[model samples]
Target: MDTKRIFRDFNHCKFLVFTCLLPAELFVSLYLDSVINWSLWLVLLPIWTLKVLVIAGALVGTIVWCHKPFRRNEADGFTDFKAMLITVGIQVLLLLFELLLCNKIESNSPISWILVFTPMYLVSTLSIGACIWGYKNARSTELESLISLNTLLFVFVSLKLHNVIHWNWSVIFIPLWIIMCLPTIVVLHHLWTLAFLRSNFHGVDKQSLVLDTIMWIAIDVPLLTFEILLASRLDQQNDISWVNIFIPLHISLLGLIWSTFGRKGGNTWWFGLREDFCTIFLRICPFMRLYGNVECKEREGGDGSEIMMMPVVTQVVCKSPSKCEPVVAVTHIATPD
Candidate 1:
């Protein structure tokens, strides 16, 4: 089975599921409550387990990259590996903690995340606080801090929504999903940018989006699943049993699994995805490429930073001494290429 293509489809599927699921799930619960409850856990296990295995693999990769001998083979030999280790550590820890906090112990696992919720919340908030402090003085803006803060904020909003708004929240949903999508899109870009970085550092012809697939499924699936489960009428009375909602989502996800990754083809379906929608959402997702590509090979007298000059035209009001039409200044701003 082609796992990578599955990863790519799932990435797009997230937005699809996000857009439709709220209304779809709610509609299912209220009218077709019987179908909603029909052996749902039995069905979700496969994808849920698949998502966990993906994380386990990433953790394994983290350990391997951390090894001195393994690091020697990488692009920077040691420097890049060391930096990636820290990134992986932060990402993995926060992801697991968020999932743990989201899942109720009485429902599934024996360990009660409620006991640790306060601490986990404290850690997420404090990390964002520290990142904010670091961002103010740092020469470069930290993407990690901003992305993490966005996720943390979304989580807070998700939890609040779970408590207050269940099935019948159509009146406020227009603004709600808009607010929710902002963070989701930001995090999505973070993952996309990381894949771009990996492609540059590894010197691969195509970027391996598995890292993003893993991150999205592992982190987002659980978080979203919790909310979906919260809104369902599992315990309420029901009649007819129907097919699992996850089956179609998983099947649609599985059907798209191919080994290929990233933008491909003469058409716009880069990495086997719709270009128009991705452009609308992912146009701002260019962190690693913001300053052009990261070159692993060193040049004789070349500095690391790549400079890009773009002509920026701005309109300015004329001074009183020279009362005239607004002056247009076309200046070339030297920014990171």
Candidate 2:
């Protein structure tokens, strides 16, 4: 009966599903590339499928918005609409870059790596500006660090690919190494805070602290391992199997998906779709109807001549405590006939 709770759960569920699918697809693509000589497009089929679904959902949402009978009470509907458009545009841009990169890699095209990565450069530039705006507005700038480091990594990659830099692949990956070290700093801070709280005789949420620490370790350790293995493999410093190299990545992705399950609500572009899916699912699920607390049932009237569906309340008490005794009560909602 709590619509807000239902919507919140739906958003969390959507995040869980996306986290599972997207990373799984990427890992599978990596695995396939190592095993088979499949075409890049074919290997990327799952990603394309997800993109198609997203674009289709956007179109459907746009159509429904244009023809809807009533306007939403809050302004979020319009904001979500704009967000959907932006998401689609970004998806298209990333897809363009992927296609170009794939073509260059597959056919040994003359297209420069810088040209292939232009879309990512543009995205990173926009992300920098967004991060600046966010910092000005007192929003989190943690993501800005990652974005800047990634952009630097991209530059290092392009230079290495173009033979403009003869540095070792591990050296080229210094930015990513720094990125990974950030979590180490955060974990150390958390430990320090915990120790301070304990030393001061302050109440500590040990359960939450333990869970947070475990989650950080689960995600970061595997992620760091994956990066190390990848860098070593790229540099031919190690002859580890590709499957083994990707195992840590798979573990990290699983940790990400697990974290999403424990997360609560936040604004996501699929908010409307999640709500619609939740509603339809509840309607079709018989067990949900059977177990739900709220429902309308037919009751015979006093004369036994009419049946009506009404909202019923039980265990009512008089507002004035002295006027009446507390007793079981049934209040019927009247209906116009």
The numbered model that scores best in lDDT is: 2
Superposed Cα deviation of residue 296, candidate 1 (Å): 32
C-alpha TM-score for every candidate: 0.33, 0.70
Give the distance in Å from residue 36's predicted Cα in candidate 1 to where it truly belongs. 7.6
Q: Which residue pairs collide in model 1, if any?
A: 5-258, 6-257, 262-271, 263-270, 263-271, 291-337, 292-337
Best by TM-score: 2
RMSD of each: 19.8, 12.3
At residue 225, candidate 2 shows an lDDT of 93
CA lDDT scores, all candidates in order:
0.40, 0.63
Residue-level lDDT tens digits of model 1 in 1-337: 2322222333432343234334433444433445444343333343345345435544565555444354455443344333334434454555465456435422565553344354455455655655665455442224355455455444444444455434343323334344446547755776676656653456542334554455445444444443343334242433323234343334333322321233221111222222333333323443312112211221222464654343222222112233323323234444433
